[model samples]
Each structure stands twice: as C-alpha cells, then as structure tokens.
Target: LSKQTKDPRKKVRMLALAHFFEGKSRYQIAEYLKVSRTSVNKWVKDYLDYGLEGLEELPRSGRPCKLDDAQLKQLKAYVLDSIDRTEGGRLTLEDIQQYISESFHIEYELSAVHRLLKRQNFSWISSRSI
Candidate 1:
C-alpha cells in the first residue's frame, strides 16, 4: 500500500496506521515517524472518522477561468489561423482582446488578456523595419 501511494503525506499516514496497529502511543508514533504529535493525533482522528480516504488531501478551490472550454478552443483556433495572414497582418494582444470582446461579448482587462495569451503558449514578438 505504501509503495503504491505516491504522495508523501499518504505514505506517512500509512506508516502511522501501521505503528498504531502495533500498539504504539501517539507520542511514540510521532517520535518514530519524525512528525508532529498533533499530526499523528489528526491522522488517527481522521482515520477513525472517515477511514483511509480522509488521509488524502482535500480538494482546493482554484480561481475559475474567465472563458469556458469552447471559447478557449475557438480563441486558440482563431490565433493559429490568423498567423501569417494578410487580412489582419501580425496579431497583437490588443487585436486579440478586441476579437475576444467582439466574439464573446466579454470585456477583459489588458493584463488579463496578456495572461490568457501567455497561458495558451502564445508569444508576443515585435517586428522592426530594417
């Protein structure tokens, strides 16, 4: 079970359980595992309250994306297709922002637009006349 578990916390919990089943005190377990006594207490409590599943990390709440998956896919396609096209010339961040606003009817801040572009692996390059 320990070998199959990849997370270090989970492995520690497994070891704690093993020591617990071996009639070890919480202080003893903490000393042997080199973890805090509070952590051992919490692990034992979690195991008793919710079994092994409780030892796993809880789900985190992350910031939701401004655009949905379909919108993102459409944006990617538009950016890729617009590259090297004569109609719009080289695409810029402002141009992409305008396109997004026009297509999605959502206004995005300049920084947000830049962040989205970067997240999509799009790089901005400046062209200079020789």
Candidate 2:
C-alpha cells in the first residue's frame, strides 16, 4: 500500500510506524530519520485501529436476483418442455405468467418470462422440434 500510495510522506510515515512496531527505539528512529517521535506513534495507532483495506474503500449491496433456485428450476422446466399440456399444446408468455400467478400467485411481466427462459438456456426456437 505504501509503495503504491501517491504521497511520498505517507510511505515514509508507514515505514517509520512499522519500524517502531518491529522493536526499533522511537528516539533512534526519529534521530536517524530527523522526524518527531509523536508522528510515528500516531501512524502506528491509526494502522492498528483500521486495517489497510479499511483505509480506502467502496460500498456495495449488490443486485438481488429475480428468481431463487427453486423458482429457477420450475421456470426452466416450463421453458425447455416440448409442451405445456397444463395449458394445452400451445404456450405463450401469458400462459407462463398465468400459471405462476395462479399457482404461486406471483405476478410477473411477460417479458420477464422471456428473460427467465433465456437465463435457463431456452430460446426462441424452431417449433419443428415440437
């Protein structure tokens, strides 16, 4: 972190602090480096309170998935199946939505069905296979 840091003073500060922790006498370090002992002590305390990762940081709560594993499995079954006899030989996004809405009572958009199907390796396919 000190090597990559833009500020040369920060590297010097960190190095002096690490030397103190490794049993170098503060007065000896200060005399050799020509700096005050107080600055070395402060940097040591700051590094101990917060690890290096905490010094420069980001915050993220990540995106929530649309479907869980079980819903995903059921959705995959619907998508890859040759026919939905439950809705007749014909199937559409509306049929998928209605089935989900009726059974689980979870209303979702029709396009969402297309996305879910695609995520499960289904595609807009030739019906000659049907």
**TM-score versus the correct structure, for each prediction:** 0.49, 0.41
RMSD of each: 7.0, 14.8
Stretches of model 2 off by over 4 angstroms after superposition: 1-63, 81-88, 126-130
Candidate 2 has a TM-score of 0.41
Instruction: Name the 10 consecutive residues with the lowest summed lDDT in model 2.
Output: 51-60
lDDT, residue 41, candidate 1: 95
Clashing residue pairs in candidate 1 are: none
Give the per-residue Cα lDDT of candidate 1 at 93.
79
Per-residue lDDT over 1-130 for candidate 2, one digit per residue giving the tens place of the 0 to 100 score: 3557876666676667667778998777777668887866666666678865323324558645456788777766765573645453656778777877776667778887677667667775534223
Clashing pairs in 2: none
